[model samples]
Target: MPRRAGAPEVNAGSMADIAFLLLIFFLVTTTIETDAGLDRMLPPIEPPEEDVIIKQKNIFQVLINKNGQLLADDNIIGLKELRVKAMDFLDNNGDGTCTYCKGKKDAESSDNPTKAIISLKNDRETKYGTYITVQNEIVGAYNDLRNREAQRLYGQDFTDMEATYLNPETPSGVRDELKEKVKRIQDLFPQKFSEAETSTSN
Candidate 1:
């Protein structure tokens, strides 16, 4: 009688090892996505301080309602126009001080970039994406002004100079020069935002 040979036993140890190696490879090489958030520093808490008076012309009010509607200075507006509006408000040179400003020097607009303030107020139920977009537009306007100033004075873009200044490998002496240049540009077009808890109209 011919006895049937038992089937060869397959080893699963190597298969498990391969799977573990694959998992490790993915863990080491896989890129993870993260949500971008606001990079703002909060002011120190002041105890019952007197209200500081900000000139009405210096304040550029922006509001967002629960329905993601944007209002700039109480007028309903689209996101596409927000950057231009912000730039105009910041560079108005109403006081005739910002010689580099290209604005129309509207008497109702901001006195100077140093005094320009964007008063951002949003309803509690406003979409986070809408708020971020608005913030970006405002910051972009400032960056544009700074870049133009840097280009005119230093023959380079302020944003690029700033990126180099922030790099870890930059030399201290070079960083110092960049710092002065950045300060000059910033002095011309400073970025200021006020996130006050003011009521917004729907």
Candidate 2:
């Protein structure tokens, strides 16, 4: 007897469906990451009771125009001189307090060391780099004051002193105190360093 011929069968109808289901699954399950933003300290909403308003007199106003020109108390100054003037102002409180030493007044009506307020006003179009430079200078002044205070509290050349016997934990308290003092100084000035927009366009 002769063998009967059989028909070859092929199944191609479900290939597209499998691919579509896989694509949908991947699309539904995948997660995309978002970028984190810059970190900064923001003010609180509610005003606290017994807010002691310290009258700010030693105001050093720094202005930067769109042209990158720097002004201290409305007087034009170069970058080098800006640092010098800022250091001077920080060192000497207009109230006769030596900012560097932070000395207190004696029984007599004498001068006590006080901190000054730095009011920075920049044009609306002022470059961010210029603003950062001014900010760095102010921070540097505070760091210098901190170092001086540390030297006075501890012995001279404290950096070179060994930590063999001294309690390292005690310095943490000192650092906290210094940080509070710096906060006070920073608070003396308005937290909003930039001023309102000027009428003239940059």
Candidate 3:
């Protein structure tokens, strides 16, 4: 027998089916990663049953000028005094109900210090950095208050301070307290207002 013309020689098989199956498998099994969002606590929409409204006070106002000058009430103060003032305010007004610093109300007095609101007014031209610094100072004040409360609650002998000074294990209770303080500040400034002195100057 001689060679046949155009003889078909086959060895393996079709890969089209395998490729199609693989495409289907990938389409069925592949997962895309999504970004995780920031964690935050949102306020409730409904009003509380008691409806005890706290009045805004001059003692609680901290104003920032366009020049980044800070004023506590009408008096110009440095960041150091700001923390001191905040602590004093919280110490005076704090009710034991506060998670941060539980200040006892004098037997004769009705006003609660912890319930006192800190009103922050920033000029329109104030840098975000200045605002953030003020916020950090405010948070620092709350942290100080929380630490004081911890000392009062657990006594000076507590050893957790060393651990707290380290990473991650520090009680979030202080941070939670700071968040509440920030929430109160946010409530006070529902709408941004120019510092009274700044408004008058312009």
Assess every candidate by TM-score: 0.81, 0.51, 0.48
Candidate maximizing TM-score? 1
Winner on TM-score between 2 and 3 is 2
The list of candidate 2 runs beyond 4 A from truth reads 1-40, 47-56, 97-115, 155-202
lDDT of 2 at 94: 47
Writing each residue's lDDT as its tens digit, candidate 1 over 139-190 gives: 8988998998888998988889999998999999999988888888888877
lDDT tens string, model 2, 1-202?
A: 9887887778989999999999999999999999664233554687877775544435567888888788887689987677666656555544543544443332222222343556677777878888778777765665555445545655332222322124466577666644544444433322332333342443
lDDT sort, best first: 1, 3, 2
What's the true lDDT of residue 94 in model 1? 94
Q: Estimate the lDDT of model 1.
A: 0.88
- For TM-score, candidate 1 versus 2, the one ahead is 1
- Which model scores highest in lDDT? 1
Task: List the candidate 3 regions with Cα displacement exceeding 4 Å.
Answer: 1-52, 93-110, 155-201
